[model samples]
Target chain A: MTALTDDTLPVTSRGMRDEMIVFVVMALLLASVPFTGVYPFFVMQALCFALLACAFNLLIGYGGLLSFGHAMFLGTAGYCSAHALKVWALPPELGILVGIAAAFVLSIITGYISIRRQGIYFSMITLALSQLLYFIYLQAPFTHGEDGIQGIPQGRMFGVLDLTKPTVLYYVVLVGFLAGFLLIFRIINSPFGEVLKSIRENEQRAISLGYRTDQYKFLAFVLSGTLAGFAGSLKVFVAQNASLTDVHWSMSGEVVLMTLVGGLGTIFGPVVGAFVIIAMQQYLASFGQWVTVIQGSIFVICVLTFRRGVIGEIAHYFRRSL
Target chain B: MQALYAQLLVGLINGSFYALLSLGLAVIFGMLNIINFAHGALYMMGAFVAYFLLNLGGINYWWALLLAPIIVGIFGMILERTMLQWLTGLDHLYGLLLTFGIALIVQGVFQNYFGSSGLPYAIPDQLKGGMNLGFMFLPIYRGWVVVFSLVVCLATWFLIEKTRLGAYLRAATENPTLVRAFGINVPRMITLTYGLGVGLAALAGVLSAPINQVRPLMGADLIIVVFAVVVIGGMGSIMGSIITGFALGVIEGLTKYFYPEASNTVVFVLMVLVLLVKPTGLTGRAA
Candidate 1:
């Protein structure tokens, strides 16, 4: 489960506006780092997870559903894309498509089952369903068990662009992240998004209006899963590996933490949250297992004292959605 | 023939733990409307406590079985009082998150001390050896676990369904504000109910310790499977949890018999199928 939606503080307050302004300056500052010869791979990783957080916010922030098995989308797409490249020798474009398509299909089946139960039960169902997929992938001959679908040839995009070069890969992932982020912004602003918010606010009223609320929720879950798969597909290319770690429940918790730390319902909070969490992981990678303790501490602290999250609290204080 | 009986035995054994754990979850859900994510962690702790009691305190299996649940129940009461109580009247998700955090902390501390490798919990002298029924041999500890858990399960059912205190619990679960108006101190009852639920899980842990090795990660894996059990059972009824727990365990055990490949996932696959045809669950009341 994630943070409650009703507790979001208003964005117009002074602390929030100052925070938004700071975030914009920070984003711009981070954007300029590649030119200064800072490692772009780390930056790309942060940006990809940032986009994922934004996609996840669509469901938790607007739809009021906490899915505990979101990693299925990411890892499923990763595995799909990897397998496509390995088995079919398909171009990178088709590989990404394969990943997205697989993730979409998986989400539809999982969503139908999970949406039957709302709140905590929904989370558990999604989690168990994802675990089922995990076991399938674990034993499926194609997954190669512990080795995973590794050494995947990041084939030429449209049979031309060389992906071995880090710069090209960075640009591809960056564009993908931006597309996801902007699409989420648009989704939040659309009339459909308003209906989702209404459903979140109170399902009874929406159902009373004959809105077919479950359809919206299912679609939202699929959309979130698909985009998360896109991010996962990109991740495998960046890391050049897609293992069981990607499918584990911990990855799901990581995304939840990123969204929670950034802001549950807010737009930009997830990005900030992802960056912060990933950065912590990078810096603390040397510390070994203590990272889990640190992550748990963060979960506790965010739930206890900083429920609005970094971006959401800032947005609320600033009186804007951000 | 031997394989079938063995699988049936395994299924029945798993069913006992499933019934116990899910029963606890349902009881807690009935009162506070929060899924105790830390339920697994506490279950693991029960096994660990029994282990420690044997090693450090020189307590035998019987004494630890009685004491571990009490200790774990007190821990649950403390959790209910400290963190969970604060989240009341808010959205239910927060309660889940709070418990998840608790689970993380408890599991982490144990892992730090115990490592991931499992520690063996030896069977007591009283429950040693195996009994052969010509077709199959049953280990005494396994038999005791199944029989004792069923007794606990039935006793719990009786307490909730037939007793006076359980009537208050059911009443409070129905409408806490109204129950409070009736001067039942429903808040305190809710805390105690959470404790009781947690206590039940710990009891399952004690039962499981003899058969399964006590590892910090033991409950983490088992709890997820139990969650699938809870889903298939449907949280709308208490008996549903116990019956589905056993039935699914048997199904799972049989899956292991016929096709070992699907053993790990048979329950989850069943969960999906149940959700498809009867979303409210086989025994659950319609939402």
Candidate 2:
């Protein structure tokens, strides 16, 4: 019985020490970016998306739940944060807190409705629920319909470290991304993470093992949503606006694309994927709608030929878990 | 009362399209096990194809209806043989992703050429004008659309439910390997089934061209609602999709008359309620 479980469930491939070394190297490279003269704005935007993608990966990669409406969390948090800062005249940290709270509530409601179904049905349900929110936001007065909430104040954190300074803001965003990333990493290696992985690998077996699988999945959903919301709150500082674009189905698709291109279940894959996609969008902005076509083509190529993704292929060849 | 009747009629017309589209989805899902995310794009393509035939080829409405589905159906078959078929035996999510990519490509190409604005397709000479049903004035084209879509939907239902060919299709769905053991061409049937389903979506597109106008992203948001309908009604039964589609459309129309503000969201709210009550959907068996 133990052999069956061992063979069926993925073996913890690489040593924790190896992962730690890679994490340290990654953190060092990212921390030194302000001194390297690379564009801080682009990195900041990518970091927000990377955090969002990592939060998304925690559910799909480890928990085996694919939410097609994660944009709801991201968009909800961004809108709330923008409102808090701009309209309510709250500080940056409080704005982020309000956003996180909104996302927390939204996740509970959406998760309750969506988690009842499994597989494709779950995805469709989440999508429908998000679209419902989209319509509400479009009509609701506070969202300002298509105009969105704009010109949010990038105030100081803790009454110091002015967010108006590019270098300071970049580090803050980087720190936020790292905090979210480490939290996700910790969750994945925990005993709870193993149980979540077992559920993903085989839900029936997990149930047979007497685990209340639904509660675990629900908890995972809330954690992922709240973290994604945190990324959204951070993004408001960078983008300075919360718009309908964040809530659109296409945004949800972009998150999926990022996670897939990096490595669906891999740790570093989402970060790499987010940077690659954001950079492509920035450079290929001149192509107009052709960019969409290209992104779509990338999706097709990934699903068909490059199913392992960029990081997945690298890890597979190196025979080390990234 | 007259306004209510008119809205109800409008709702039924919308219901007809929903029924046709969701019916097609159910058929495709049964055979392919993939939710065709590109269904909406192909539906939009059908309208575009009709427009092209009328403007360039000088084919009228009736002929365009017959030709568009066949042409787009052929394209869907090519997609199946080329890209989608390669994903056999993989996770269902890959199919959803691949089709989503196809949707974006098709919609993006159309957006590039046509821009984001709507192109008006005039109603054919025969479909113009209206009739007095004693209660309300009914547009002749709208009336024709309802009657024709009902006929097409039921005909599809008959084709799938009460035919020898459908039996083979159902058998294959149940056990493709066992059906293959009997020497039937199961793969060809799968392709044809996809073609048939896509053809149904194109047919709905053709029917709605005059009413909704031809637009690149017309089907984008609409497909999400249909997915909700599928989730609520379940893809297990063909008749279930038909009834649920029409029922939701009618309910939405009633909401439009009763509370205009909530009109856009009534279906989704209902979907959440249904999911809460029955996780397996109204007609779905446990998967």
Candidate 3:
């Protein structure tokens, strides 16, 4: 049972030091990728999903709440930001803020409803709520039905940095990703994070210890949702559209696959997982439906055999958390 | 009035599916403690199996109805033996993740071969067309679907609640170790329970093929709604699941008549309301 509860796995100072070193090296490498021949847009897209996966990890990994419908946050933020940029003509930063705000409020309502149930029912509730939103977006006039909010302006940031430049957009996305990553890292190290882990390990014990476990779980849910929205808002500028695909259940599944393959509870696992999966999709684009088949195979393999994931496995081998 | 009656009929038909699928989920959850995320994929496979039997093997609907479930159930049993067996004694969430993976694989393979356009399954000659009623034209096939599904649901409820085998199953669910100590092969029973649950999903797929085209992704979305149904019904009481399934369907139908925009969302809204009122679900035992 403890083995299954990966979220509550103890964190060590040595593991934190190693994780920081890996983060710095990875950041420097990502920053220099533009200088190389690798496509910056692809990396930007992957960064967005990486951040999304990380936010998802914050809940499932640290909070032990597997939300099956995370795409609602991403999609909500994307739509809000896209609408702000396209309809209200707001600047990019403000648009992103609007998106985050929307996601924050949505999460509050959804978290209130969802936290009432535990385990599988919690997952189902999140999924149902997201599906309900999906239908609304599908029919709502503001979303333009199937066409979505397309050709959204990348718009200058703070009326200074011209985001139309590929490198500029890439760096903006990277900054957003890094900020989100550090926030999650900080959150998990805080006393609040400890309370969350306690609840995850045993809610009954936590409640007995006089901890308001539901409040902690709800806050974690909101934080995860807000961060996921931030990632989604960043993505709209890169993808230049907010569409149905973002809100689809498959998108939710894709994020889960990303988190699972990277290692559910590890800090760096989701980033690696996101990169691996996004890269696979990029290279396998020509393979058509085989991409799904391959992704599915990876899922089956990971669940059955490689539950620790790539970074998690490496971390285990090194006897340190990644 | 005619439109209302027609919508109600549609609701009843959809309710039958809700009842059938959710009932399968409850049974599987009761025994295996796995959510069976692949249940939808299994349902899709059931439809596809029927499709293949008709097109490739020249089998009739009646034969496909009986055979598809058995074949798919056997396939499910094999899956239980091979993969799902390993997941026992772990957190129930692992079972969910594993099954979700299996679902993606199953749906993806079908999509690769069948495409998403959907293949038509002809209604058997004996069940084709409709009967004219006073207010609205009642499709005989639709009526047959409701009635037949009701029978299946009741029969399943009876088997689980009233039979000797069912007592063993309930006993195992309460205490597998104790049941094993009593000389029953609990592992094999678990596999058979999974098979029976999968078979029920297949049965629903076979029934739905003629009404809804046999498509690869058909069950993909439908399964989510069934999950909501399970949440509302509280996966604890078998009869509660059936009654709630049908009630929600009719409510959805009435919503379609009153506010079409809300028809798809009404069930989920109801689920939220139910969760707020009774977090363990209508009849579910406390976790």
Best by DockQ: 3
Better TM-score candidate (1, 2)? 2
Tell me the deviation in Å of residue B170 in model 3: 0.3
For residues B1-287, what per-residue lDDT tens digits would candidate 3 score against the true structure? Answer: 99999899889988998998999999999989899999999999999999999999999999999999999999999999999999877778888888888898899898988899989999999998898887789889999999999999999999999999999999999999999999999999999999999999999999999999999899999999999999988888889989988998899999999999899899999998988888888878886
- Rank order by DockQ, top first? 3, 2, 1
lDDT, candidates in the order shown: 0.85, 0.91, 0.92
Lowest-sum lDDT 10-residue window in model 3 chain B: B87-96
DockQ per model, Cα: 0.53, 0.59, 0.73
Classify candidate 1 by CAPRI docking class. medium
Q: Summing lDDT over every window of 10 consecutive residues in candidate 3 chain A, give the lowest-scoring window.
A: A6-15
By lDDT, the better pick of 1 and 3 is: 3
Question: Candidate 2's residue-wise lDDT over A84-144, tens digit each?
Answer: 9999999998999999999999999888888899888988898999899999999999999
On DockQ, the stronger of 2 and 3 is: 3
TM-score for candidate 1, residues paired by index:
0.96
- Pick the lDDT winner: 3
lDDT of 3 by residue, A1-322 (tens): 4535563233443446787899999999999998998989899999999999999999998888999999999999999999999999999999999999999999999999999998888998999999999999999999998999999999899999899999999899999999999999999989999898788778889999999888999999999999999999999999999999999998999999999999988899999999999999999999888888888889889888888888778877777878
